[model samples]
Target chain A: MQLDVVVGFFLLGMVAQLLKAPIKMPKGLYESLTLFLLIAIGLKGGVALNSHASGDLLIQAAAIIGFGLVLPLIAFPILYKMGGLSRIDSASVAAHYGSVSVATFAVAMTVVEANGIEYEPYFPLFVALLEVPAIAVGLWLARDRNQELDLKKAAHEIFLNQGVLLLVGGLLIGWWAGARTDSLMPFFSSLFHGVLALFLLEMGRIASSQLGVLRNFGSFIASFGVLMPLVGAGLGALLAHALELSTGGVILLATLGSSASYIAVPAAMVVALPKANQSLSITASLAITFPFNVLVGIPLYSVLVGHWS
Target chain B: MKKRAFAFEMAVSFVLMALGLVLVQLGLPGYGLVVVAAILMGLSFVTRKWVAQTANVKVAAPKRGNH
Candidate 1:
């Protein structure tokens, strides 16, 4: 799996920062790109599901949800005990890991398309399904059972968060509109990669910014950042194989497993786990895990597909 | 210098690499990675001796001059 050329933009952004070159991705443009990618991915999945929806999908959906739930469970112990993070911080980091990164997924999708590897089109549906479970699980782990969780607020964060709302909303619109949504292909699907490159450029700048702050838990957290994703991808490959997904499906699943959230989880955790040190998890997810997954884990997971089968 | 502490960290990382291979054989690649992580935690514990040693090392105080 050759590295995608779009990743070059990310390296460019990081290099520019290192050189102290004047460059800025406007706040508005960054937000718009994020929204564009989210809606595009969701719409594509919804369109695909219009034809392919079936009983087996229900099983796969349950399994995907289970996958989301399990990732954070596995990560919390390593973080709290091994990484020596506080309970709140550990739960926060675990939640971020367990959730998926849209940008990484977009990059993997680009590579898959460039290679002409056929994958299940309804994959975006699985993406929507995956966004929530880890967050709920993480919150459960962090909060005391005796203390009442504000159900309304939690529901809003999990279901109505920007990532979920756009993905699921786009999915439903595509599913309902079906053939009518074809007109949308020009904007949502065609311009997808271009927007993603811009998004990643901004991500590179942000990830580079996280570098100076990493000294606090640099080694242990960094180690976990790289290692845990591999673990997630390894497990995801096994699950995908058991479900008998295609080679492309397997790769996507593995990529999904390895990618961690910098967007949805942080937005939700800020409201949910206010006392938790958000920077620790954000630095680990964005600065460490996100870059590693985009650069290395995606390709490595692709290679492991042959062995795991 | 407690070379033992540094050696232990190095040894743990190498053992994890080998352990990951073994677990892959068992088709538990994910669990293998997790197990490696759990054990990797131990390296942090063993390195505390080195941390203590470094903390105790006396640093020469800077000579005060014109501000």
Candidate 2:
């Protein structure tokens, strides 16, 4: 399978940052790019589900939820015991890994589409499903038992956070509009990769800046950051195959499973897990895992999955 | 466990995930994930126990509340 060309933008961003080249991604452009990708992805999934909903879809979604929950459980012990992080730090890191990354998923989608690989469009639905569960699991790990937990605060952060609200909202709107959206596809569907290219360029610059922090943390976070996604992607493949997803679906699921959340989870963690160092999670996710996924991991999963089946 | 040991453990975990996927493809669609999760957790518990016993050369606990 061929690597997506947009990945070049990520590398370019990193290079620009590394060279200390004067590059400013206009204020809030990153946010706008993120919003575009999120809605585009949600609309794609919503449009697919608008026609494809069935009992079987529910079963697949339930499986995706299980997939989400299981990832952090696997990650926490490693970070806590083996990596020797504090309990909250380990859980925070685990939650970051356990949750899915939209940018990574977007990369994977582009990878498959570039390869002419046909995946199920309902994947964005799975992306939405994969977002929150790990955050919930992370909150459970981070909360002090004696502390009076704010259920309302937690609910708002988890359910109505920027990522969830826009993705779910877009999904609902896409479903509501249905074929009426055909005209707008020129903007949403056609311009998606270009928008993603711009988004990744900014992400590249940002991720490059986070590297030193990950380095300071030492080898385990870096190593786990690289390897954990492989584990998640492997399980995604198995589960997708079990669900009897198409080959493209298997690739997409593996990509989704393998990614760590740099966007949604970090924001929610600030509100929910106050004691957990937000930067630690960000450094690990964005600095370590994000680049790896963007540069090497996406293609690696594709090749691995291709060889598997 | 040190970083090296943790890396080794992740390697084992990756292999276990593939093994589970193969099992699922063989016929047991529903149980493959459970099997993978079970064995991985079991591996974690066992390794941590080993790490505790060998506690001489451990990865230093991370400093917290510094974010």
Candidate 3:
């Protein structure tokens, strides 16, 4: 039942794109859907934040941030030396993998909820936190003293990014309002799956549009996109185990770790690493990593979490 | 000009936050709605910056010809 609803919409998206169907989500509607999902996730997290021990939350947060920072560092060397990508391209791609994708996260949430699995609510906070550091790491990896870095612009782009602001702001509002805001449960919670289905349908369309570019990127990059998520999930599983997170929390973290950012990081990279190959990084994230996570990584991670726990 | 844009964005964000609060009070599913408000506010700021940047590019293009 869980698989059919989530994956069915995604497959429908791909089929629509494949058939050259004229169906399209309105220009800003997709963004609106994204904003709604993020906030919904954040508010839920805020409500649950008080129940968890502050120390455990802090440790989990720190570990997730560390995961974000480390993923790029691991990716850069592989891209630069093994994949034969230039420093800029490597950093750009690495930054993308390091950052979390909200769409992918949303899909994972849907799967978990459909399956009646409980997860950590503050995962949205991790989403917000994970967005920034990888970007910094990416820019640093590509840094050259000869090139003038626009520190001010980069900071503004990262901190004030729409994704980060929405998630963080929602978290604060949800936390502050708590059960007082329970009235919103009907909209935020009940309608979540429907909104998610709509969003995934669009995601399928977008991901399918990139199908033609896969061959051009070569077998190596394509393989890396699929394999890296598994590696990241493995790391997430280990972290989740260490933190003693519940099975649901473990899967969520694994999903977070496995997913790649197509939105926030790309926007920042446009400003910070202007010379980076935009197509390569975008394709890697949106075309390859995004689909893989939604289709395979989420379920795989859930199984792994079950085994681990 | 930038300051004005920033202030405008802040105003919009505040309004959205208020609307979200009202929704919550009304026992509606408003948490996600509030975040949407925040996102829209941020988009306003981003669009303003984009427009300003485009203008800068246009202005700077002719100047670069002199070099």
Candidate 4:
């Protein structure tokens, strides 16, 4: 059932790309779609909790943050060396491994929730938080203060990017609104699932388009894109075992562990390290890793999570 | 001009965030904000080309007169 959903999205995205219809959705529309999905999930989660606080929630949130920080630290070195990329390219790619894709993570949260699995409502904030640090690390790796303009630009890119600000802002708003159940739930609650499916469809469109770029990537980069996620998942499971997280939380950690930053890191790299090979990083993230995670990584991590639980 | 460039980027980001909020508030379906971001980003790249062209023009005009 899970495999079918994953493959179904992939095929839809693939078909959309092949049609090559010039129906370029506007940037605002795409972002709003994603934001709506996230807030809806958040609100629904909030409504589910219904103001009940749990000791386990904080632990799960912490695990998300912990895995968010540590997985990239471990994953970057392997991807860098294995891909045989330069310091800048390697670092750019590595930073992506660290940051979480809120969209992808949101999708996973939806999957878990639909399965009647309990998860942390605060997990979305963790997703927002995880995006910037690896960017800082990536920038630090390519740091050359000699270029004042570039440094300034990188700072702006990190804090002020539309996606960053909105995701972070929306998460905060969702929390605030989620708390005010009487007024907010009407707008944010009912729309969660439909928005998520729509966003996933758009992602399908993107992954399909990038499929052509997979072979263009060298063996090392392509293989590393697939392999690093599994390695990261294993590390996450180990951490989950040590932390003694719940089965659901363990799966969340492993999913968080294995996912890469296609959105945030690439935007940061474009600003901070413009000379680095955009094609390599973007292609790896889009063509190889994104599909790999949605297809293979989710199930693999779920199994690990189940074992740990 | 550098400050202006910074302002430009900031303004663009603000517009995007605002647009995203409005669309969701209005009940539009599809992830519009991310797509809007990607479009504005692509548009910004085109604008950078314009800036580069203008810069080249400035450099060339002065050089031709000096020569």
Q: How do all models score by TM-score?
A: 0.85, 0.83, 0.79, 0.70
- Model 2's CAPRI class? incorrect
Query: Could you tell me the lDDT of residue A176 within candidate 1?
Result: 90
Candidates 1 and 3, the one with greater TM-score? 1
Better of 1 and 3 by DockQ: 1
Instruction: Count backbone clashes in candidate 2.
Output: 0
DockQ, per-model, please?
A: 0.11, 0.11, 0.01, 0.02
lDDT of 1 at A136: 95
When summed lDDT is taken over every stretch of 10 residues in candidate 1 chain A, the lowest stretch is A300-309
How well is each residue in B1-67 modelled by candidate 1, as lDDT tens digits? 2244334334545655666666567664444344444545554554454555655663322323322
By summed lDDT, the worst window of 10 consecutive residues in model 2 chain A runs over A214-223
Error of 2 at B2 (Å): 5.2
Kindly report which residue stretches of model 2 are placed more than 4 angstroms away from their true locations once superposed: B1-67
Q: What TM-score would chain B of candidate 4 score versus the native chain B?
A: 0.49
lDDT of 2 by residue, A1-309 (tens): 455899999989999999999679789888998999999999988888888889999999999999999999999987887778888898888899889999999999999889888888878999999999999998787667787778889788989999998999889888888888898799999999999999989888899888766434654566577668878888999999999998889999988888999888888888777888888889888887778677766776676666677
lDDT per residue as tens, model 1, A23-108: 77665998999999999999998889999999999999999999999999999997887656788899999999999998888888
- Runs with alpha carbons beyond 4 Å of true place in candidate 1: A145-148, A306-309, B1-67
Model 3 Cα lDDT, one tens digit per residue, A1-309: 235476788889999899998776888999898888888988887777645538767877888899999999988887777667888999999999999998888888778877888877677788888888999999999999799999999998888888788888888888888788789989999898889899889989988998667545543465567657867877877887788877887888888888889888988989888898898988888877888777656765665466446
**Candidate number achieving the greatest TM-score relative to the actual structure:** 1
